[model samples]
Target: MSKRPYLIERYPPSDRFNHWFVAITFILVALSGLALFHPAFFFLSHLLGGGPWTRILHPFIGVVMFVAFLALALRFWGHNFLTGNDRQWLRQMDDVVTNQEEKLPAVGRYNAGQKLFFWTMVISILLLLITGILIWQPYFAPYVPIVLIRVAVLVHALSAFVAITGLIIHIYAAIWVKGSVGAMTRGTVTEAWTRQHHLDWYRKIKKGEIRGHDHY
Candidate 1:
């Protein structure tokens, strides 16, 4: 049999651009945030222009990351809807972890873990946004009560930590699965690659549409 070529643009240029946009802003926010968290982490402030600037820019960068991520997320959330099949896939996760992938169910475009990450991220991001706004000073803090701001700060910190942890997992997963990074890097994946990892998605890509995972 002739080898199938990798042809579909899995991420497309727009998606890749958004991914990088979120990535850079996330890094900036993380660094500046660490600087504000404690004296030991104050060295990170230097990257943003010393102590004062770090405080000024950290929230700004975080806002940028949040908006960019929200845009990217809205585009992809439909495919991530959970279903009976996804639950079954979760049950077979051990086979997935063991790389006995052939023994597991064929997911459309994303596996159970990927879908879980997607949903978890969405919730965490929403929490971060709402909480961040509450604690945001020179903006809404004066209008809001001090106790509410304190509560918002606690929620914001917790949600940011969760979102960051999920981001690390998302990145690590992209790296772990060969050809996965190619989707974000070059906006495409080989036909063979798509077929091997997401047979149903490959069929749709071959058919010329840019969507998959038609959940019921």
Candidate 2:
């Protein structure tokens, strides 16, 4: 019998590092942003060395996260773009929910859920960046009008809320899916996991001769 070919060399070293970078920075940003947003949320500032430091670091950390996440998203955006198969998969979500892979649709590197998440994150990040630039205190705000700054703050907070919620869901999905955390941490998943959760990706990996680090 032939040996099963190794697959799931999907996330590269930089890709994994980029993901953790964004994750960690976003946590810092969210906590700091919340601390400043409301008196009730002041406790969050404690995580970043009190309110004054949190305020100073929030924007800095946010910019770092945005740049890193933008690069990461650009790297994977083409692969994660929605396809016909993804639409079919969404329409047949019942099968996916039931884990009936044979009866469900064939997905590429990313599934419909993942594609949705990818776009959602992209839009919110863009919104956050634009709005943040508008109300960044000293730099851009002085040049912009007061009304616009108020509007930007509203949009910024709303986008942040949405982005945070999506991130929570993304984390939950990663945890729920077996072998997914391994991919992020170790930059690879098991052959069985590749075949089961992402068969189309598995096939392409084998055909394209992609193999995991462990294979090397």
**For this target, which candidate reaches the highest lDDT against the unseen true structure?**
2
* Per-residue C-alpha lDDT of model 1 across residues 168-201, encoded as one tens digit per residue: 9988888889989877897777666778888767
Judged by lDDT against the true structure, how good is candidate 2? 0.86
Candidate 2 colliding pairs = none
What are the root-mean-square deviations of the candidates from the true structure over C-alphas? 4.1, 2.5
31 in model 1: Cα distance from truth in Å?
A: 2.0
Against the hidden reference, what TM-scores do the models get? 0.89, 0.92
Residue 137 error, candidate 1, Å: 1.8
Worst 10 residues of 1 by lDDT: 207-216
Backbone N/Cα/C clashes per model: 3, 0
Whole-model lDDT per candidate: 0.80, 0.86
After superposing candidate 1, which stretches have Cα over 4 Å from the reference?
A: 1-4, 207-216
